[model samples]
Target chain A: NAGLTDVREAVAGSLSAESGVKLSADHVVMVCGAAGGLNITLKALLDPDEEVIVFSPFFVEYLFYSDNHGGKTVIVPTHEDFSLNFNELRKALSPKTKAVIINSPNNPTGVVYSRAMLTELAEVLRQHTSDTGNPVYLISDDPYKKIVFDGVETPNIMELYENSIYITSHSKDLALPGERIGYVAVHPKCADAESLMSGLIFCNRVLGFVNAPALIQRAVKNVQDVSVDAEMYRKKRDFLYGELTRIGYSVVKPQGAFYLFPKSPIKDEVAFVQKLAEKKVLVVPGRGFGSPGYFRISYCVPDKVLEGSIHGFENAFSEAMK
Target chain B: NAGLTDVREAVAGSLSAESGVKLSADHVVMVCGAAGGLNITLKALLDPDEEVIVFSPFFVEYLFYSDNHGGKTVIVPTHEDFSLNFNELRKALSPKTKAVIINSPNNPTGVVYSRAMLTELAEVLRQHTSDTGNPVYLISDDPYKKIVFDGVETPNIMELYENSIYITSHSKDLALPGERIGYVAVHPKCADAESLMSGLIFCNRVLGFVNAPALIQRAVKNVQDVSVDAEMYRKKRDFLYGELTRIGYSVVKPQGAFYLFPKSPIKDEVAFVQKLAEKKVLVVPGRGFGSPGYFRISYCVPDKVLEGSIHGFENAFSEAMK
Candidate 1:
């Protein structure tokens, strides 16, 4: 009755084991996708004007998702190295802050948060909850959780904090974005976890998702262990990152995910991306992701496509410099 | 980009022609399901505390859908025959009323509204709209439009009224409830039609559906012209109705869809339904649907199952009387 389908439980259990989180099937709420999970969780946790602090360079959809539930999005920029900026994040916390979303193997930047970083962040949240009595939850948004590079492990939020929630999709890991399949797992230790799960189920219905499309749920059930070709993406990311850095662009080496974020030669990343697009190369400006002076190149395409785009990347950056 | 996908437009066109409504692809919004469509449309139309008048014996979810977006649901009781009680509906209308939802070939009661009833209702709306100068849009929820009996015609809502929106799911007609695919169509003549379309598309995205499941959308595209065998359901409805009537149950004959609504033998519809369930026959109590003194039995089942339920219904009815 609580969206306790056997297949949903199967994947939830599999995910629980992998994340080292003690989650029963009752803690799992199947949703349309990670976005659906996030929206519903926000809907459950927020009242009008509640603040949800998000790390900068986050998924742009976070702003809209937070606003949809009548919540304010307080964006705090990460450290210069694209890692957790505890100083600024601590400054951002308030009684009004209902949650802080962490998207590791993070979008745009492609930087994965280390376990130590997450452990400290949880401690900060714990202190805030005790001091303010506001229960500022940590929400882990983990689309690239399974897409880590060079054996970098994504932290399981449930391990770090009793008040954390997880919203993740098989979009990247299982390559099922078009399928719109994901699940929300509440840690057993999450405050009022049972009631929160129920609230999510209610939001799922009221938001009109009703439930995730059933066919994919069945497919996911049978193939819960299988995943997309992560090695292929890793190679592509390496090639793209190596080429851009050799071309004299300042770029952080991505530990996971399929995107390379390189500093634009020009001050305006949007203009730089525009030039790139004109040269038959496509990239999203980092400004759109709340991180200026950098642009994101998705390395999810065939190697040949990446190989062909090398010249465009060179031409666009050189042209932007001129 | 607009959410006007090729397949979405194809089905929208097919539904437009079939329903005798003049609608372009721009008017259609492919949603998660009929419920999804309803929620988004309500989100688009209703402001906080605005009133949405719904008929009694309605789908229980209507209240929740309206309330999800801060709209107040005003339940107007239907006629004793379970048809439109226009007098009550008219009295229920006020400046606060933003819209009215009509679920014809209705759920729970299975009442397929006649064209005359709809024409009069539209006239009532016209008068109200003119008197208050507040455009109260008519929202027709038509899941059972394709499953009508006795050759009753579903009103071409656009022809009956200029200001209307039609939301329906293929779940019933295409036997695809698990598929969770449907669309919302604004009449070409609807006031602020362009804005309404934009509003629906905006609501579709912000509501976290992002879009309907692509797999089912593609499937429905080519199968737009095909529908489940309504005759099969018609036969089942007849069988269920005949058996119940023979057993001295007072029930309304369903014109469409696959349900029988019979007055419970006991005053407490919930207890009566509980008794039926105790006899291994499951039915929804009328109170659940805002329509008490009755219970609903879905006839979308095998003939043998209906045959098998005979003794249980008889036993449950007799026990309820005692």
Candidate 2:
């Protein structure tokens, strides 16, 4: 249930090379996807009613995944620029807070947490642990780690936090979400890391993801160094970011991932999204990501589709603002 | 999260053809494997502390799968011949009995449930449901359905039970356990079948499967009618059954799958198993399947290995009896 050893070894090699930290195959558990990894991790770490703190504008599924294993989700709002708000986090941490989930090159928002940001976040967690005598885990969900724009490299969470569990999938990096292959790596230096690894392996089986698809495990074993061209997504991001801003929409310039989380011209993003939909422009309401007054546009579509949406976006923004 | 349309349609076609029941793509939900299907089914059907009945000499994983969804396992023993023991089943039924899981051709015992037996079993469940005004779902786990021996065609539980949910994987039949492809087919006439399907689809995502591996789903769509040749397994079953019986092992002749459940010469099947292992012939103690005084031999090995194990089996049996 841990995973194919060769695949784990390949992953370990890549993770070590990228982070400059030594990792062995024993640290990894193969999973169906980031989703599977998160579920198993929560199953292993959570007891009844334990709190898992997730930053606002988070992937919505984090709530469900935490709840699946009897963990309650405590949503803490990020800063206006979607950076870590350590003051809010400090107030949120409690003895019941078992883990904190961070998605870098995050879903919906596309804001990449830098090394400085992660280090500060790690310090907050360490301080909480020292004060409460309760260790809080940092779960880094990094499916979009390789999909960054502007030559930005997502920081390795393992290097910044000893009590970190790094989870990632080839979904965005390899553009293979449908293949359902990923791994969860426990930081070997974490408190009771060996016991945590055992719990992960046990949950992997009992949770019914016996192992990742064997075909993909073998297929990706040799391709650990390979990834989809982020430049292509970057091009799409540039066009959409530029067009949306030109059309009077206020959007944060995304650093990574193929999403533009633009403030709605109106306060109610769902109403604004409906207006966009009426103009034949579709986007997810920011409320779906636990943020209001904004909507998320995915720019991963074909060039023609992105180009075509320009007029619709302009009309929707003009009408909503009016 | 339900699954690829074409794949679900293909499975529906095969299930309809095999069961002589009209089924639509809507009735099917693709899952990671039989294991995934069972977890989701239990998740959808169970309330906390509800009971799930399993026939002992059962797949050991069923306990974990049931508990994964807050359902407790209530194991009712089978008859001496390993058929459904209705009297025991009747006594085991309660208002809290949410589901009963049956595997046939069985796992450890390899005893296929005849249609007459299933119809009778269905009747008992129906009676209990009517008495308590609570629906008792029949979950048929059929990974070994196509691996029957001696011209035995496994009966379709869906046709016999209106509230049945049929779950099977290509693991044993297509030799694709590593690929982890499977589907769950809800009986069209099942109580609240539509709601149950929605619950299943919801559980599919919340439980972290999202969907079965998409690559294998497409790969197996065209091969639903294809299965590994049963005669190959039948031959191996015959060889092992014949040899073990000739060596004075009191074994129930298996009718399906690749297992032989034989009575250990000593009441302590674990000790008997150890003696067999000492002789270099490995088998599982029946207590692993919630039955004692017996051991299970899986005969899916090469013929040479089977032949080589005869002396070991003979020595272990003689030593245990002495």
Candidate 3:
């Protein structure tokens, strides 16, 4: 338990320092999982009927998390091909909007916003905060921070927004989802730093997580520098992406994270997912992520499974076309 | 993942069994922790400005939990010796009351409510619910159920109140708190059972527990009948209780659980707690628990530590009297 806390603190500290960010030890609230981190943050930040802005094709749980706390989620859906849509985001902003969530190398779509996009988003956020006189916090849900494939690099949000709070976990990076441990690091320079820290600590305790699991907190702290073998996931992503494109399926190549968000060969995603399940392919429908006609395929399975599913993918495509 | 779902279902099944009580499994909802259960219950059942009655010397977090969700807590102070005060409870209730929290084998003050008292309390709850139109939920937080001493039996809240929901964990019972595993078992007989379960499931997911730790859920299933060595706590409780009493400190003999709520040999509890800390004994002040002029000593530590603290307690008592 001791070791895990040390490792987590060290990693969080190193990350904050490397980005020239500032946060006291108290601002770092460790949790059971990134999912826990998300829940805790929402619990602390949201009050009834307040709004949190999430980009489109976002994780479905974001909607649930926000709604549970009586917060409305304003979705600024990304461009049709799944890139950041700043024009749409500007339209989504309002005085009641409490926060904006950015997931880079994100879930489903797997698009990484360039630094230029982030710089512009920050400028817009600053202007919005000034205009509304209500600061809109940035929640960077970056569980896939280090799961990049090829040569893609994801920028840290703390560098872009002083009010940013980063939530990440080792579920993907260390393959420790079963372990359920992670932390929330708030940049010390954020507005109302003390209130923010207290809200987070109170949220952590009141939300039913007094602290992270003592033993796993120490375990992750011990193996802070160590990471999961993502090579296997990278290989699975490559194999599936290759086979789907070959079979005439349209997909945006996964830049990072172990998921493929491929446009359905047919326009109806729910029906497409049902047909795929018939072929024993258990992909989650993208309609759940707020986008129809696209579906998410998790590539976290083994290499042999991906290789074996190639023929199944081809068959699903043929049946759909006919 | 499979084990977690099974454990959840098992907990659900436990709630549904005909305990010969009025409630069925419909009342039970799996939660992140008892804390999560408390907040969700408060959120679901409470309307703005509604009152929640809590027995004083209750868990301090109860106040924070209730307030955060928009309910006000009406504290009914316990008797001089920290036993139930039924008259006070009768006076405290109003039509706006949402629920009452009863922690038997109570924390800080380890006085277990007698069966007679519990039955009387049940009658109070039933009458209040009938008269109010809004059913008053009885939330029994039971992390210390198996941590009692002697031949005492902890009364089942489900047996007493048809509207009761029990939240418990292996944390204290199995000494697995760092594991963050627990359940919320609602009696299915509660009013609006289906909606309650739906709210609970949403609360569990939205609160960020997603589900309990999958592996620990499996591990706990194997140890349902296993318990922490009660004799160890019994011995320590006896030693500390005896030593404090002999040293001129008055205390209610603990019937269950591992805490000794000793009356401050002196009246100033904050000062007393600070002085004890000076002597390297860490006891929370009674003021923290909504009762002054008394403080708590956690007897959960090893016997050797309790033995070593005997002289410390003696010296502290002597110094306080001066």
Q: Report chain B TM per candidate.
A: 0.96, 0.98, 0.93
Model 3 residue runs over 4 Å out of place are A1-5, A13-27, A46-50, A127-135, A264-268, A275-280, A302-322, B1-32, B40-51, B94-96, B265-268, B275-281, B302-322
The chain A TM-scores for the candidates, taken one by one, are 0.96, 0.99, 0.95
lDDT per residue for candidate 2 within A115-212, as digits (tens), equals: 88998999999999999999999999999888888877687998888999999988879988677898999888998899999999998888888888
Per-residue C-alpha lDDT of model 3 across residues B1-322, encoded as one tens digit per residue: 2125556665554544434554433444445456766776677677788999998898998987777667899999988877778899989988988889988778989888877888898899888888878788888888888787788877778877778778887788898766677777777667876777777676666667665666666777666567898888888888787778788888899888889888887789899888888888889989889999888888887667788888778888899878
Worst 10 residues of 2 chain A by lDDT: A313-322
The best candidate by TM-score is 2
Q: What TM-score should be assigned to candidate 1?
A: 0.93
Q: Each prediction's DockQ?
A: 0.62, 0.79, 0.52
> Candidate 1 residues B1-322, lDDT tens each?
1344787689667757766775667878888889889988999898889999999898988998888788999999987789888889878998999999998888888889888988999999999999999998999999888888777788767668889988888888888766678888888878899998899888877777777877787888888778787878888888888889888899988798787889988888898888888888889989888988889988777888888999999988777767
Weakest lDDT window of 10 consecutive positions for candidate 3 chain A: A1-10
> Looking at model 2 chain B, which ten-residue stretch has the lowest summed lDDT?
B146-155
Candidate 3 Cα lDDT to native: 0.79
Cand. 2 Cα-lDDT: 0.91
C-alpha lDDT of all candidate models, in order: 0.85, 0.91, 0.79
Better of 2 and 3 by TM-score: 2
